[model samples]
Target chain A: MNQIDLGMVDWARAQFALTAMYHWIFVPLTLGLSFLCAFYESLYVRTGKEAWKKIAKFWMTLFGINFAIGVATGIILEFEFGTNWSNYSWMVGDIFGAPLAVEGIVAFFLEATFFAVMFFGWNRVSKGFHLFSTWMVAIGSNLSALWILVANGWMQHPVGMIFNPDTARFEMQNFWEVLFSPVAIAKFTHTTSSSFIVGSLFVITVASWYLLKGRNTEMAKKSILVAAVFGLLSTAYAGLTGDESAYVNASTQPMKLAAYEGLYNGKAKADLVAIGILKGQKAPDDDTDPFLFDIKIPGLLSLLANRDAGSFVPGIKDLVYGNAQEKIVGVKAKMERGRMAVADLAAYKNARKSGDKAGSAMALQKFGVNQDYLGYGYFSQPEESIPPVKLTFYSFHLMVTLGCLFTLFFVVFLYLAYKNSLERHRGLLRLGVVSFFLGLLASQAGWVVAEAGRQPWVIQNYLPVHIGTSNIAAGNVQATFFMFLGLFTLLLLAEVKIMLKQINIGPEEV
Target chain B: MPGYSQNNIFFKWQRTVVRFYLDGFRAMTVGKALWKIILIKLFVMFAILKLFFFSDYLHTNFSTDQQRSDHVLEQITLQSKIQAVEDKK
Candidate 1:
């Protein structure tokens, strides 16, 4: 209960978000492009085609550029945990740091070792060994993603940890449970598959540029064919995993799900909003209409949430205020219990300091009873539990809409490429170039929905963000935030300049 | 089962891998630029950022692990005490 500095919290949050978003820009491309390189190399190995080797080598160059900058941004992200969010680190580092450490020790080393082999051993190694190296790099990069996502998923839905009153921390109880949590699995699949779509989009974008310019015609067609097919499959897989993520959110973080749908009133047969425009901000339980205009499918939300059209999906108001019929406990009640838990914890510490064993034990027992609602004690009011509705709603909808558009974009390009008439379609080729930016936008929007929608809480029900930040001067965090922004922007510009130069040099040169 | 010939083969394989990397690094085109970027970025991140901007506050302030844990405990428990007094008011 140290007096929280709102400014420090905001600055720290902004710094973390800025670093994460910048890191993400490079990660998805690395995730997908590595596999595409592997596929292209596999084709070269199988067919003994020089063209395929050139294609693989071209993509691999871009991948290497991206991969280097990704590691640069990623290292800083891990350090921020210790610097900006030391409280969260100290509280759950036992569990959270384990996966990240494994990622560095196991996955990173595997990637780094094979990456040297993949890039340098092209002519030196045998065909089989070279292909093996490429595949290893792909697996290693994705494995690195797996561990990072597992740590993030734990934050969103913390499991397999038990709170220790003695240390004032949550200690790991079951490592396997933490690793294999359903939320982690869904998040990994969804995030990595979406990354694959971004990779494919990048390939198609560069290839389409070539087609539009009437250069590298055969190479462009072949590259488009491979990327479109890969993108199509990844889009489908992403869709499936996206559905699983929504279903998991429905149960574990229903307020987030409610915010995504802009639901303020509970309903038995909730309709899923297909497209909507928000009128303005409305408080929970207010009579004002949340949406200015909209279209929706009846009972789809209930079906998505519970796999039953008739099942009730609670909304923001129902979650904020207790619903007797729905058996939903309000945030107000949770806050009360959380306050009791906090008070008892304080009493327990004081009693132990005074050497009153009986009094300490009594307070500890009361604390254990209400420990589940512990994070709620930090909030002053029930409505503090609600995340920004408009942001979450729009981000989720925009991501979904773009996901569908990418699917169609891939299908059309794939058809044109196979038909051997892709060069004739100037307009679609232009769209293909533009679609890469849209893919990046969709990927970023998905993160906004995931992170921004779960506002207030850093560890779901366990800890609020205000309590999780390190005790630091707001000015220090703000200064570092600008420093990182300037540094990352410079690096991003350098990466783009290098990538564009490589693209202009063309695959024939590669 | 192991013999001089087997040991010789293993040594030869290791030498081949080493030679491969050395030759590749020597015969670089774009890779030289990439290596420079990586080195410069790493220097900035570690030398400048880690040295000046970011520090592990708990580790810097507290000498012992126990002291750090105790500090966090104080922060959490102190909040509850303050809130309890406010509730009474």
Candidate 2:
């Protein structure tokens, strides 16, 4: 019942974060560019255009480079589950590990098996088969993303699982619910669409640079036309899914939503912080004012969160303090309930061990009632419940702002490319180049919001991060953390060098 | 491409992967030694080596679920080496 002071927790967290961020750098591009390659290859096959094939081959080479590096990081990412978070590996392994195991066994195998053909089969296989291989690679990669995201979604909003006290882990109760969770569905669409947008931007940026250089003008122009349209459509899709995610977060993690919105008190028809600067002087856990200035859209937050304009939305204070409009339970009460749940589970185990069946049954019944709030049992105080609000608020805003800008950019770029005037507007082309980094930043911020906003909880309302780490020594974890950090950095550098060399080589050379 | 239904896309993809797998295996016969080396290396690393090195700690150290969980809790809740270092500093 007493809290353990595990210093390995921070090192483990840092290592995982390092690997995830590094892995993401390549994964988004791989997810998007695979489709672009397949699309280009499809055109080549249909129209008998050598130019299309050239474009396809060029992007496919880049995709290969990105894919290799993504795989390198991805392997380590999965391994870390066992090495760093062994406790988590067991605690939710039954439910959480299923999708992950499926990702490796099914999706990764599909991608890896077909990848050989996609790359090497060009010389050995027929034209149709090669094209098919390319498409398969794309599908496999996205399918891989789907399974992983499904696992992540379950962590964010744990569903279709029952905690077995005897096993001391959550097990899958309904495979379909786990797979088809609304949170997972929204996350898949949102995340993949953003990756598509990132991919489209990469194409646009590269093509724009080519246009500026007065090289590969035809290829560049055509590529822009394709990428711009795809990007525009993907941007719209990302927006819709993002909206859905917000609703899901409100339902599942209202505190996270409140923090991101900078909502400190309950309000009926809550306004959205449209454009504002959050006052950053206060510690995240401190109860100082959240912002200095703001522009808000009236009732938009309420509408967005609850899908009802007049619905009462609880903010940090209401959620934390138990207001008259206690639409949400305060952290204190939840922790108390969680403590009861924890004690009951412990008692049930103790009673069962001693062959006291009646006592075990009573304990089990009590635990079942409070099991949902069990994660809060680990927290020593109400203040521990609050996530880093300032970071969440800003990251949410920055992601949204950048996303909106990129969507607008894509719209204009697509129109210009459609009319074959994309090159004429040099300024807009330069902007297109800039939007590549903007798109990347937005994606990163989205990730930060998703990860950091759900702080303290590795599995929201189920497990806390500090308790979920492997029982490794902090020194050992720290040492490996540095080792992986160094190795991954070198790999990233190598990736960049190889990519540049390949880019300079150009499609004509290939 | 735009009008391709989701189901069709998935089916087409599945078919392509299966075909590729078959074709790849057939093609591998020509480079039999290379395929053998790759598969062997993979098997050794993932299957053989993993069995020796990555023993499941919870399973090995504890028999009952309660003991396993209690150990994890104790490890996490107890002041760690890093914390001791920090305290010394």
Candidate 3:
């Protein structure tokens, strides 16, 4: 077997993160703008407004530019699974590949088919059929999000699968369980709604720019009105879904919840850290006071996590050290069990080799019993399982704060548009324009928390990232990493240039 | 789309879809020929060509699961191997 190389692991991780981050930049906009285009086209169809058609075509052009780049960024991720994390692919591909195949064969094709009609069939097809095509594009894009998120949600909380000792893999046993996972549902709704908020923010920002320049005033005003109402509705839904996400984290990944709060000590009725600054650098898994000055909301963590204000919320120390009252497994114990699980797999294989059916059965049973803690075995020390708290905490807090702030931005923008006084408040219009980055930041921060917070383990409790890297040289991976970085950066630059050029053309020309 | 095989509805739908696909190919014969090239390239690259380059090292070696896993464990826990080599030196 190939040896584990630390440098290879790091390179593979950096590659995945870089590719995924760039891909996300375009995906959210595509998702949000697809629906927005459909909505605008529907209005055009209903009211027979040439202005609405102009707006629809304008944003649709931007959407096509973004979506085209998204397709380029997207395919690499599927290939990366095999190239970088081949073991992980082989381990869970039976279950994981199903979602990817579904996304490609069904959802992607559906989106592409209707997208052609929506974009090129304006004069060729009937108005009603064109509207239907627009809506189909929206539905198809969202459906694609659903399948991808379901696959990811399985990683956060693997279910509906059983291990096969002989094949040394986890195979799908219940497709429904994988499909309708609670975490997946919550993540899908939360993520897409946040994307919608970003989309609305994008529309408002561009429209605000036009309003400021005093060109296409009617289009700008109409676009802002639609985006504000849409943004407000989706942002509200995001809050509700965000709550569900927190609930899932609190229940399944208590350690991650602790990191989110930057808490180090255990306590019932725990105070939520709304704001704080870390005092000094502390060693990993240390039980010392990690914060200097923390403004707290008493029992809010308990409330947010469990919906019961008095319920116990375990801290980093409790999770890493020990907490008898909370029954926290502590990272060390899980590591031990993880070793036993690995050992059992070895024993099962040995027994099978010797034709000892009963011994193989016993070993298989042991593996089944201990497999839940299997990933911990890959870590030499408990501290390795501890993710960077500062990053996770900051990312999560920014996502929440930005989400709340954008809700207010939408309300204020709506009010301005309604009063026909948006032109009077250039400052607010500029802020509305700035909300685009703020919205994207919030969306990306949410991703950082989700991906970075669940550190060490790529598939939550079952698999560590180090164990999944391909059997390739570190230098080779590094070379490929840089190649991808340069390529994606160039692609992103080209996309932005094309988009800016299209926007310069303005709504009337479109 | 659900297949309604109870009343041969599924067969009818399948026929319609197949006809639509054939008509599309006929309309864009050049594109259709290009698609044939694309499909052949895909088959060769993923299915036929992969077998020559992508050898399963884990399966090829370490006959038992124990041997395979131990090799991984040894790889991860490399400090002992380094220490032993240093002692021998």
Candidate 4:
């Protein structure tokens, strides 16, 4: 166990992160388009306008393509749970399985069933039914998001469940506790809005491009306007939700929050780094550099965490890296102490065999002293002995920068909308396209930071990463990873080709 | 081990061996095929009739809610060389 091969952890970390990234290319669109489709159909309902109707159909076509890819990418992720992280699955399957089953039974079917009607039932169904179909797709997508969030929230904050050593699984003791986790709620709200932002900006970007080319001017203008309004509002919400999510993390997953801020220790008044290197100290086993530069945060960190101008946030040094020596020493010393105690206990038993009660008692007392070593069993180490601080530091900046950009863009766009110049403001229209890419970039960076920061631990304070990977052949993982990787690439290519071709044509004239 | 004449017993043994291979083929090819996928979906929806009312699978395994909501600021750089590097258009 001590000299465990690290190859699996490396492979798994690479595979899961890669798969998630590819899967994500489709996810934001799912969350965003579902809402946009509903909005388009609602406009059609209110105005009885054929132009709005056409816009709804146009986006639906895009949504259908994205959804199919999303669904296909998603199934791979599920199988990966059992394939790559079988130990983690076995340990948490009971708790995790419930939510997964619910999503399949409810969300997938709801969306898929109604999605068909929304896509191909233009002449087959009534207008009201079609509208209902669009709404159901939105509901199904959101609901699917909700259930998955619940499970993930559990991983982050670990509520409503307790570990059973005999079965080596966490059993849910309270259903409601799992359902309404603080981390889950905050994350769900923040995440859904982010998706809305991605979707809105995506549609707006293409629509604006169409406008620039003067293709389908009437429909394109309307599409751009709808995307703008939703994009602005949703982007604003994404920021707000991110703040709420940060607050939740600050309170719950303090280690992650500290990592994000690159705080090495608790300070009197922490200056939030707008830019800086995140090199400090690494464990004895780690060989990372001790210096990085340019991390700069003024007072923004305090404001976000505590809503106070100068509240102290514990830096990673004080809690994680700062106490590294103690954790390692504590674990090692305790393990040795436990073994010594067991040996003493055996001696006591030997003495008793020779009919020496006093000597046996003395040995027993010594043995009792070492029993304290058992406590070391729970001292799980972080997955990465020393994190790639430079990568984490840069990714964090990228996420924060994109977040601030979206904030500014939405603020300005909202003002333009209120000024009734949303359509005419070509500057804002162009900015929306840039924001679309920025949002995607920010999301990717955010993901990188979150997964990398957790480093080493698949189950936070409970499981070491190397212990949690599947005990399968290396060749099996390589083969499947490559197979799926190839298939996913093909799917993504197909999606992009179709999307670009459709965007080139723009919406058909009403 | 059927109780019968020698000819009858021989025929039964042959049938059993044939059925074993048939079942093995069914599990490997048929059960794991796209047809099984369609069946699982159908059973979850059309046969059992609770697919719409159930929302558990999405919650645990494939929900965007968890991915989006739990944005842990950990940066993981993964190098994947599984596919031919194509343009990300």
lDDT of 2 at A218: 93
Compose the digit string of candidate 3's lDDT tens values, residues A1-510: 344666778888988898898889988998898889988998999999988999998888788777766664565676667666766766776888888789887675788778667766777679999999999998899888888999999998899998776765678999999999888998899999999998999999899988889989999999999989999999999999999999999987877888888877867798988888876597645567788888899998899999999988887777776777778778889878988887887787778879999999999899889988877776676777778899999899899989988889999999989988899999998897788888888999999999888886788887778776666677866866776687678667767776777777787666
TM-scores, all models, native as reference: 0.96, 0.87, 0.87, 0.73
For residues A1-510, write the lDDT of model 4, one tens digit per residue.
Answer: 222234655666677777889888888889888989899989998999987888897888777667755565565566666666655666678788888889888775898678666765675568899899899999889889888888878877778886542234568898789989888888688778878878877886776666556566667667656776787787678778778877887777666766666665555456777866655555433444333666555777877887886877765544533444333232345445644654564565557658888987887777566643422222333222334555666787788777777666766755665565656777767776676787788778877776676554566545546555554555556655665577568667767776676666656621
Residue-by-residue lDDT tens digits, candidate 1, A1-510:
256566788999999999999999999999999999999999999999999999899899889888876676888986787888887888887887789888988675789788988988888789999999999999999999999899989999999999887777788899899999989999999999999999999999999999999988888889889999999999999999999999999999999999999998989899999999988668898857789899999999999999999989999999999798989999999999988987888898889879999999999999999999988877777888999899999999999999999999999999989899998899999998887888999999999999999997899987888777777889999999999999899889989988899899987666
For model 1, the stretches where C-alpha displacement exceeds 4 angstroms are B1-14, B80-89
Best DockQ among the predictions, by candidate number: 1
Residue A467 CA displacement from its true place in model 2, Å: 1.4
Q: List the residue pairs that clash in candidate 1.
A: A1-B79
lDDT tens per residue, model 2, A1-510: 233336678878888888788778888999999999898989999999899989987888778777655564566665677766777877877886778788877665778767887866765678899899899988888988998899999999999989887767788999999999988998899999999999999999888888887788899888888888888899899999999999998888888898889888768899999987888565434667677989999999999999999988888887776675555678889989987877787788778879999999999999999999888777776766778888888999999998888888888988888888877899987887677778888888899899888887899987888767765667866776776677668667767777777776677865
- Model 3 off-target regions past 4 Å? A284-286, B1-89
For TM-score, candidate 1 versus 3, the one ahead is: 1
- DockQ-based ranking, best first? 1, 2, 3, 4
The regions of model 2 sitting more than 4 angstroms off are A1-3, A281-289, B1-89
> lDDT tens digits, residues B1-89, model 2?
77677579787988877776677657542234334433543454366434543345567668877787666544432435224423534
> What lDDT would candidate 2 get against the real structure?
0.79
Question: Interface root mean square deviation of every model, in Å?
Answer: 3.3, 6.4, 6.9, 18.4
